[model samples]
Target: MPERQDPFATLFDMQAEAMREMFGRFAGTVNDPAEADLGQWTEAAEQLRTMWLDFVQERMAGGGDPANPLDPAHWMQMAQGWARSAPFDPAAAQRMMADGMELWQNLAGAMLNTGGESAGEDDREKPALPRQDRRFSDPAWREHPAYLLLHQTYLMLADHFTRAAKEIDGVPEEQKGQLTLATQAMLDAMSPDNFIATNPAVLKRTVETSGQNLVKGMQHLIADLQRGQLTHTDAEAFTLGENLAATPGKVVHETPLYQLIQYNPATPDVLAVPLVIFPPWINRFYILDLTPAKSFIKWAVDQGLSVFVVSWKSADASTKDVVWDDYIRAQIDAIDHVRARLDVPAVHSIGYCVAGTTLAATLAILARRGEADKVASATFFTAQVDFEKAGELRSFIDGTQLEMIGKLSPDGYLDGRYMAATFNALRGKDLIWNYVVNNYLLGEDYPAFDLLHWNGDVTNLPAKWHGDYLRDLYRDNKLVVPDALEADGTPIDLARIETPAFVQAGRDDHIAPAESVWRTTRHFRGDTTFVLAGSGHIAGVVNPPAANKYQYWTGDSAAPSLEAFVEGAREHPGSWWPHWFEWLQQRDDARVPAKGKRKPGGRGDKVIEDAPGRYVKMR
Candidate 1:
């Protein structure tokens, strides 16, 4: 392995280069870089970049073989050459070469150890166990010589290629990311477990079913084709306004762009400051209101907080022209509507994911115009204001890529499937191939999970707004820089936001990495609470106190870095909801009668519709 380089020599230089490359790709012309299509290629490669598409294509050709086009070993051979070609890379080639030597030597040792072994042989002669992966969890993988050989061989190749792709030192960061994605996708798609011939469990299941599972698998494949993606859950098991978003509420205000649903208070008294939720239009709002037990909205109402949520209309021809400012304005409109309906000077607000990014901007606008008092406090869930650390999602955000995807959709709007594919590709192991093996290979039933159902219910984005948002946030990353971005003629400065804010991030969240989410403390001027939640984006925020499943951490919200924060933090059992509620109480615990009527946002005596209104039903 090579020694480290001096920070004075390359850290800043590399960052500058990466930034230039990212923005260059984003700002380039349609013909820019000839790789303008790289983003689209990466998106399509999500199937293979992340490993679903190539695996499917190979499977269509019948059982797995060494000559499979997407084999990890084949890609690993190419990837090793990439490492070796990095002339300026300090030790990248040396490290990879040494690693490869170690891998082969270890594998050879394992083979020699296992040479004369048969089933249930002496433990001393057995090979070293492969790394623990769910894919190799079947006992037969370790006990059966033939399967064990394939399993260990695949793991070694996967590790070698995955490492080489990740450490390729000479390429620009974006290109490196794409290559890494492509490499991993190949490895994932060509895993032994994915093949009927190589996987003991799958092969056993196939034989037991007398190949009837293949028939079931064909039917499942056709269903996935019709559904347009692998089934993550039993979609038929859940429905909105019933088993799903069943929280009691009424759609009291309606607009072509949004429906404002005001929840009926579960208690006789509710917080004086009404609570309005701003969910990202990228997903339906029902995510926060899953089943009653899992529903954040229902839980908040039960905690004596009056709740309202904005249900954004799915983008179509009517919404193609809605720009970034429009979303900011719509959020302000909702805040004002809540204040007017509840007869309160201010209300508390919550924004999740992308909506949270816009909310920070809205607060900046309000603060700039001396209207910051519109909201009493704010909370953000797994939201990112800076995109530099946004993880794999950033890989698909260059300028040409954005343009190419919208061109494939109506009125240049981004089809939800593209967004879906991008996200699914990020965690292909869990999101794509796991389901592929289970449903299409094993012919098993998909789990009936509310989260997966909501995940599948994706929303389209207006092309203008989509491109603008990604450009400013992901491409340019202007939000964290004061006044770097402007919305509706208001120069946005996040530091201008003086409202007390609570920022929660998932420790393992890939979309909005914890480090990125926590750094918002640097931007806001107000009192801020930063807590790290357990699990990924969805489970982290949607966790109900009753479930008591995951833990959270809090310490120096003012910590300079994530590691520093962890060093100073204390782990607390259960959800962060109670802590947030206590913070809200400290701000203003004043209570009002749950207003006794479900018509808080109603005009005179007319109710617009039931909760989870028409706008949410658009898809």
Candidate 2:
């Protein structure tokens, strides 16, 4: 009854108890039904505030006034120091330390055993060691125990954070995803590579530059702040109509939704069926016609195919009422215009990214309404009709995030810049930090890259259309389900689509996962050929044969489970363009020699403007 607790133990217990109480209060606020309007961010903000205050108090014992301690930059610096204050869970850290010790012991034993021994046959034949992670590749860091310790500690913490986030109980899926993302982002930001203290390369650079890199980095940061966005590439280096979207074409037709550009025939003989393209409106249409070397439009035109491209108008407050049906109607109108202009029985159709989903829906509706004959065949590039495996981007489209986005778009149109920023975050290391370091840290100019330039040229999404897309396709997943989606007063059934299909999936695509794109084959009853390209979404589609780069995989002339397909497939070097062109030719009617007398616009009355039209050039 009179047993007294040790004062040191009692003090530590009291401190731990205080922390638990604080966390309990924060968790209660999160779980409270009354705070539902605030969503999961309330707790995140509260935790961040607590962390910030603790960090400031700990660091500024003899400090001057902490001006704007809540500043994001200050918070970032504080977060980087969090590991020094016990960032990892105690249990997880103990386990990691034990494993690390065992590894160290094995390494010491190996070093002890290797003493002037001649290489044996088995040693010589040994397979090369697995490639090291880029962050740990530098040999200079291996010479120092402190550097090694920092690297190992950060990696161990990263692993534990990922595992802990997945094991978190009673968290909403979206919240869990956000937590995992945040954890990884923190670990990446705090990585040894980012600092001079832990990174030998950075230390050497600092020594050589006499700390000028820091000054240059500061100047770069100031410039970026003034610009209000991160610049990844030099946009001034590339002009839309001159160097990019340079494929020669004229706008033959225009609608509220899009401008139709029929390109000049490069080959004397053109296919009887014209190819009508539906490009995703989220970005500018120039991705398909980025450059002479990678331009799909140029390749198609050069292959004796008459080509027409749909360049969607960037949405504005005036076009806020535009919806899914409006896009479908515009597509139908474009196809009709192409058929009328070229005087063909049917037109070949191709869709890229979001356009592919819309095109599939349009074709399905057309099939239902007995208008399927308008499209001769269909090809999709890096598109998915099914959204089940839509990858990491899906997490940002949940109810909470969607609502937040809607609130931000007061003018009834989602800002294109915001969309671009989100995409940049998906691969922040390559798309963001590297640029940050190059432009700011190293005081270097952004390079002139066609792809990066195209990436920066984004377009707005009409509020109604964007909302419908997120709710219908992503949230409700109604596209694949029969009668769940209707356009032009007709219900759609993908099984009714009789158009021969060519579906291309990128093996490394994180946006539309390969399996997600491969599933489209089952929806079409007509012949389908699915090819798995060997890169991410953009590079895979823009692959040129001359590059002699990334290989593609093809199997038993049919679509199957992605795993089975890849397993049974044989790898082929170079691009998939030639294979796709051959497939198109097989189904196309006889080619006819081009008549120079007939320009791009068949009847001049329907012509609106030139290629790379007003819509594309619009801000």
Candidate 3:
């Protein structure tokens, strides 16, 4: 690789650009000859200095920890400002107030109805009143009128606040996204569950445990503090090769960029066309091959499909200068290796999350070079090619935050743990505080959840590659626009992709909203099947038919908009996996006997070790 440019310098340049946008002039030295206001600049500098001093003084007064000077209260105040600035809806507010009053009245009536006497066996067995919101469902909470009032009022106000934020008119899309994120974050923080006094369950547990819960919780807190971070999982409970990534596979191919793990086939006959999967490098590829029960790779092998997965090397100082081209090359190299080993003309391909986006780009590059036929079929799982409405995650992608993070990095690579923490902030109540309460306050061990264990295994983002990805895909959205993104000296276009396409989106995926995924259908001018799966991002994709869980939606017609498509789509009873496989079986040729061993000099590249390669074990 060429000499790496200083990320700090790039960050400084980005910061300067933002400052120029804000102040209408550059700082330090004014270069613009058109306008110069020395007096105004001096006054602004003084004001900025005063503001900084006030912030520092406030932190000192609050008994600053130095590490976490910005207390919860300070963030709450910022949230208040964001909420207050959102557009006001008087009618919505009035309805919320009226509902709050009615809720209080009903709670009082319910309390009176219970009376002073203890309930009989039948009465005790009776179910609590039905509530649409699951967060407020508890018999103890239902019995308390004050608790109900507070909960109902908070819910009512939060509902209106969300609506009001969406109703904000004449704001830039980025500003509107920030407001939506701000409002959501504030509401999540103010949840009744967060407070011991308001949460009947936590309070009851505290009393029942005789304050031992608090003591245990404090211990958990102290342990995390000593580590200088939050504990994501009970790491001691699960081992990678043993319990987590236990799928049977061989490392048939390896590159500096990725490891191609080829799973042992469960069937004697496999599909004529082999399958290759490109998973997001942000996390371990084991999410797809987490365990035998949930592993998609294992399922694919069982279903008589030869599977190959690209396990991207976790970024480090040596790989920090790796660019997007390197990732694309890995995908291409893996595909060639699979094709060569299987001796197939073309192979079926799948991409998940960021990997999907990369795959799409790779396909475009191939299509431009008249090699599109290399991939017989393409499938994207919860991936966005067009990010016009990329959801709440986009709120943190502003140039300012990106630059700050870039400058703060001691190494050229961005820390995976820090990125993981940012994602936790998006759903703080569930990801962060739930653990804080269960592990720290209650002094209880978190259950051995395979998914959570897999989640804790994160991979760092190459500073240069990740920067390109965020700016091009999320910031500029160059993929959808023709000739905007160039790969391998060719301007790749999404429209050029006319292969049989299957796009799957999760209904409740906050990270990559279903609507954003749906938009990709418009870009592909081929036989496109868009399936709307139920549940959040990871769970929705990992869902197996055996689970008898989350339903999916399919449409005979591709409606212009997501709303119309959803309304017209027919609901299916089980996992979307079966639906996708059914579609895959048709496109794939007749089955052939599986090869007992991989081809010698597979794709003309040397085989490294067995599956779940050494690179994956890198910290």
Candidate 4:
């Protein structure tokens, strides 16, 4: 007959169409945008019921359950019963039918004990059992039969869709990952918690507040729409150089692309070599210097390493024409300038995330120029030079998506909001739906979190810079290939960079998987040391020694795979900072006078205003 489309593709298309229609209606009613009504909500909910009913009926339809035709419980029960009575099994029929029957009977009994929610009818008055999910953690969700059944069914459907995506055969690996994420995003969006009618907590709050909570929620929603993204944190809570990125430092160097800040040393004497950190341009550099208490820059400076951080300018019309070559040249120029100004032969180098990828390239260029010693040592924090094992993000980059993204920026750059959205998609439940439920659904203020405030503080990417990164590094996997990529007309290779390198990654990092970070050891033909920290991307890297929160693991560097590395690794309690500090001491323990209260500027100029500078204050 006809070629069947992928289930995830069909599901995604339906979801997109549904969202478009829903938004269209919602937006059309927003003349006095803050004034929202339940009639419209009821209409949308009915549409949702119809849409979901059609989708579910197409998959499994038999006994019509009027209580909720969209409910998956009845269809799921029918499907389970069918599987138990199937004429053929994936394996031989011997003992399979008997096992299936026994399993089905047990499952049916369990269902009965739970009041048989499978029939799509439940007594709302009777108390229901508690279900454990952060979204459904509120007691009302567990105590009300309607809500308890709703959340449980949603969880079951989420699991079923997830497992279905995983089990789909013959799909390409990348496509499969895309399918899995897409299914999850859809399922999360369709969750009972996201809808006021379905969310018991939201409904309870609305009733208690006489519907004022929804009016407030509408106001918040309108404001967020105007801003063009979800509010993830208390926006008014933190300001750069006041409470956040407030480390004592001054701008020493400035370029069209970035401004370099040199922190006044905390110690009387510092290491012989200065530490220059190249943070990812995709975000503001202050992540390394969020606050004095949480600042890695402050920690490193206190450890006697003269610290300098490069604060990248958020790309706009001015830097829109910038490309990869300019970035490499600017970095080299910065390194050389620092060496010349400090009268030091070389400085210690560290790159975080994308900056690490480019730093490796810079090192390669230095190696190609026969000046490999320009960098005394290199450290990478959650940085991926090898993309073979790159995380869930890699799967999102394909020919079509890349091309579409290339056109998204009319101003010759990709907006930071898109990047933020993508990152949020990676952890939709936590990053997206969590905020939606709390801020919009429950009419609650976003919690005051410095890191989240930093997260919401996004930076745009130059089109060329953004494109080159996605294609060369992620999609093409060209960085590890010798001479496959070039910066400033020099074909560079990671293998050529023989500088002693230190790579640290979070074991649970979603953006850059530890396995991929570990693979950097193979590509860099240097005495590379790899360390695994206990958290995800930001926390793993920003982990301070004093806080002593998460643990890190150190292992034999010769271990071929991450699993092998972990197997032999010893777990140490607390942050990885101490281990890294010790590692830095091994290379250059020689002491020199710290650059104390001197004006943080170039060799000639008086000063570049103050620390945190003017650029960081830009939108």
Top-scoring candidate (lDDT): 1
lDDT of each: 0.77, 0.73, 0.74, 0.75
Better of 1 and 3 by TM-score: 1
Highest TM-score: which candidate? Answer: 1
For residue 51, give model 4's deviation from the true position in Å: 28
> What local lDDT score does residue 538 receive in model 2, on the 0 to 100 scale?
94
Candidate 1 displacement at residue 87 in angstroms: 9.1
Worst 10 residues of 4 by lDDT: 80-89
Which pairs clash inside model 2? 268-594
- Model 4 lDDT tens row, 1-619: 3343333234334334434433443345443435546665665456545645664574465443222312334324323432332232243343444443443344333433464333234345543333357888775554333344456656655665676666666577777676667667767778878997666667667544545566566667656654656788888888788889888878878998888888887787888888889999899988998877899988887888788888888888888789988888878988987887688899999999999988999999999999999899999999998898787887567775677567667778777877887788779899888888887777787788889988988898898888888888898899888998888888998888889999998988989998899899888888999999999899988888788799999999878888899999999999989888889889889997764333255366566778998778777
TM-scores of the candidates in the order shown: 0.82, 0.79, 0.80, 0.81
Question: Scored by Cα lDDT, where does model 2 land?
Answer: 0.73
Q: Write the per-residue lDDT of candidate 2 for residues 468-539, one digit (tens) a residue.
A: 898888777788898888887888888898899999999999888888898888778788888999998999
Models sorted by lDDT, best on top: 1, 4, 3, 2
Quote model 2's TM-score: 0.79
Ranking by TM-score: 1, 4, 3, 2
Better of 2 and 4 by TM-score: 4
